[model samples]
Target chain A: MPAYVVGHKIPDSDSICSAIALSYLKNAIGEECVPARLGELSPETLFILDKFGFEQPELKLSYAGESLYIVDHSDRVQGPDDIDDATILGIIDHHKLGDITTSTPLECWIRPVGCTNTIIKMMYDFHGVEIPANIAGAMMCAILSDTVIFKSPTCTTADIKCVEALAEIAGIEDPQALGMEMFKVKSAVEGTPIRDLVLRDFKDFDMSGNKVGIGQLEVIDLAIFDEMKDDLHADLAALKEEGGRHSVMLLLTDIMKEGSEILVVSDDDDLTAKAYGKATTEGRVWIDGIMSRKKQVVPPLQDSFAG
Target chain B: MPAYVVGHKIPDSDSICSAIALSYLKNAIGEECVPARLGELSPETLFILDKFGFEQPELKLSYAGESLYIVDHSDRVQGPDDIDDATILGIIDHHKLGDITTSTPLECWIRPVGCTNTIIKMMYDFHGVEIPANIAGAMMCAILSDTVIFKSPTCTTADIKCVEALAEIAGIEDPQALGMEMFKVKSAVEGTPIRDLVLRDFKDFDMSGNKVGIGQLEVIDLAIFDEMKDDLHADLAALKEEGGRHSVMLLLTDIMKEGSEILVVSDDDDLTAKAYGKATTEGRVWIDGIMSRKKQVVPPLQDSFAG
Candidate 1:
């Protein structure tokens, strides 16, 4: 069987594009590689595929009995269903590694970059493989999405350089124009069910014995949050009860402000106070100058939960 | 309690210097950090420490009470004895990660470099911390020792840059002359017992539950092997049998040629053949361009063992 390249479940634009681009580059270098996805593609990801004129890769639940190359995420919880049994040939990622151990040594290209597509771009440069325009366009969109158009703290100089180079290859004259277009598709969830909206960009983490879920939404203003605050609280409370999660936090992030107004519903009230170092105002708190969840949110929460 | 930084169980010149240098840098930045060791010091390490007018750090079987920042390694077999109980704050190393997992996320700096000191040098440069002469001299010597004075296949352009910068700070006009001086003290193994000499730079490994020990001796000539072949074989056989090891391999590495003539004493005859993909000629085989045990030796053998 050919090697399948995939990203984590709950596929974002970055996960989808990186899998497509990395598998393409690997196949270009005479390797048997195919892009695969673990879950249903988001609407923004579909928009990127359509814009780039590329077909969507096959969806997969488990890749057992096949050689695999994982991208975008490293945590076993966030990976495919068969990640525990699959023969992981390599990993290309940009996150804190989870509990994954290989029987033998494999190439692990994990960096503290804003996106895995940046690392994949570095790989293509090192191997002298020229990425096609479609792949380049897809990767460029992912970078813009993940880094919040270079406004995120995770956006490093390496990522900035890659974005400039990829944009030129993809014939994108104005990144802001493209970014706004993608965000328009990204935030077109006004009519989505409250539970689905909360889980659109959600991830679960295990802190000690607590199961915690965090969901984020990008919006033009906080008025949408005001409009649906009660329903969101009810959904989060019900979801927490159903999943046995100790806490649930939602980030109603404003794209222009570069901050997250957090709304937390938890079984333990002191958990939020300990995690953010302050008490919330009626289940809402403000975190100014916070963009990326991995760098800003996860570390502090894990530290508090450990304590 | 302050954090303690240490290397692997068999502390080499590079491991010792890196631990000391990193601790000092961390302490300078206002973190309570101390240098530590897990094993007895090698003669070459002692020579460098004495030459730099620095004292050896405290030897520890395990730092169970304090959080750790491991410098040179992360494998459980090579970590502190109480690694399972001790909380790890971070890891900075240059090796393939073994079966080690953290409860919460922690900072990990793993790079494909020649030496851990090289990574620490980049750290100091990035942080803009000035290195004192003694620390600079110690780190410089470690870079030279680990890279075999830039002759080993593991040496990269980054290692070369670190050597040049450190040589200037350490006030060494000629690195090669100093390298020879260090190596003379480094290769003084004639008077030691055969067992001690063979285990001078040794590491134990666990590959799919198979126990292995590989030791390397960097020498100016193979005449030493001709002199001690019989005694070395007797000791390795006794050690393997007593320790219940699957196999033990010794590499008599020639510094000038960048090659290692391997000698195997195994309970399983096909183990070496399967690992190396070639039959040994009467208990010996020469690998012409092998340098790094972590990169070159461990991966292929682990793959063969897993298969």
Candidate 2:
């Protein structure tokens, strides 16, 4: 069987685009790989795929007995349920090293970059493989999405340079304008179900055996979520109880304003206060300059949970 | 202080040379780094360093409050005692992914190659840094030592290509002859202390919280250790007791014979049978084509322990 190139659960643009682009590169280098996703794509991801003239990857939930090349994640919590039973052929990620152990040796290309696609682009260059224009477009948009259009603190020079190169290959003249267009699609919250909004960019973490779920919604303005905080909090509470999670958080991130309004629902009342040193008022708190969840939020929460 | 690049305890040629060569590459890229050894180097490593006109790295036991770039290892058990207190700047390894998690994003270049020096060589090329002849010579010797002169099962095409490139840089006409010369030095077992032999390439593993120590001696012949097996077993027993380890194993690997005679001194009597599916006589068992402790021995033992 051909190896499956898969991404994390609750697939983001970087996760989806990385799987596709990396699978293309691997096939170009004579490796039989099929792109797969663990969950449904969000509006932003859908927009990027449609704009790039690409089809959504096949959905594959369980990975038992399959050869997998995981993309965009290294954490077990973010992987398929039976990942332990699967043979992980390789891992391409851009996050902190997570608790995943393989019995045999495997290929790994993990870096402290802004996006996995940036590392994928470097791999393409290393192998001297030319990326297709549509795939390059998808990869460029993935970088823009992950780095918050170069406004996020996690954005590095490598990410910017990759986006520039990918944009040239993709024939995109105004990448920033395209980024705004993608975020505009992501900002469409009206008439959307509360669960859909919360689950759009959700991820569950296993912090010291305490399951914590976090979701983010990036938009040009925070006022779109101002009137919906109560419903979002109710939905988060239901999600926390349904998943038996210790806490469920939703970050209403205003990309232009460069901050986030966090709505937290937890079994413990002081969860936010302990993790961020900022007390929550009715399970809500506003933090300045908090943009990246993988960088800014998850680390502190993981440390707090460990302590 | 510059970031210290160190390898696993009981340093071998690959461990020592990878640290030195990677530190040199980092320095060429304007990153200040110092090569360090976690423990005493083996005779093989010492020979390679001396032949390449390089000094031995400084020994450092504790890593508390220091910035570290780990080479050839990712497991916490094989790292410094206070590694949890230190900041791990990056990891460059060729082993299975061990249980090590970082809170922040870090650079990682792990591959299923035969040697860490091969991966470091790729890093040098990736950074467009020219490796010095001395470092190239040391790296080539390290690869030869780890891959058993291209006879190991862990050896890959990448490793062979890297050796060819490094041999050109280091002016090595016959790489296999140099490999044989290094093995002759490694095969010198006469007049060596029992403790020094056992501790030469030893490594401690935390298997389900049960500390298991394993060591390997790769030589051109196994007959050299026939008369010394009893003393080695006694020393392993004492070492196990002193360190409170559940087991201590030594692989007398015959590189030329392409096999190993395993001397296991474990708390349990059936460890060899359970781990390798082979019956042992007086804590000794022979297995054909078992030259790599990391590949052939450790994985099965780890799985058996986990079970």
Best by DockQ: 2
Clashing pairs in 1: none
Q: What is the C-alpha lDDT profile of model 2 across B1-307, one tens digit per residue?
A: 8999999988899989999998999888898999999888777888998999989999999888899899998898888888877888889999988888888888999999999999999999999999898899999999999999999999999999999999999999999999999999999989999999999889988887799999999888888888999999999999999999999999999898899999998988999899888978988999998989889898898888888
Worst 10 residues of 1 chain A by lDDT: A98-107
Off by over 4 Å in 2: none
CA shift at B272, candidate 1, in angstroms? 2.1
Task: Tell me the number of clashing residue pairs for each predicted model.
Answer: 0, 0
> Candidate 1 lDDT, tens digit per residue, A1-307?
6899998878888888988998888888998899988877777889999999988889888877788888887677788777656778777877766666665435567677888899899779757899888889899999999888888888889888998899999898987689888887887877788887888788888776788888888765667677898889888888899889989988888888879888888877876678777778888888888677787788788778877
Query: Each model's DockQ?
Result: 0.16, 0.82
lDDT, model 2: 0.92
Task: Report i-RMS for every model.
Answer: 4.3, 0.9
| Model 2 alpha-carbon miss at residue A87, Å | 0.8
lDDT by residue for model 1 (B246-281), tens: 888888888877788888888668766787776677
- Candidate 1, superposed: residue stretches over 4 Å from native: A1-7, A13-72, A76-96, A101-199, A202-307
**What's the distance in Å from true for residue A110, model 1?**
7.2
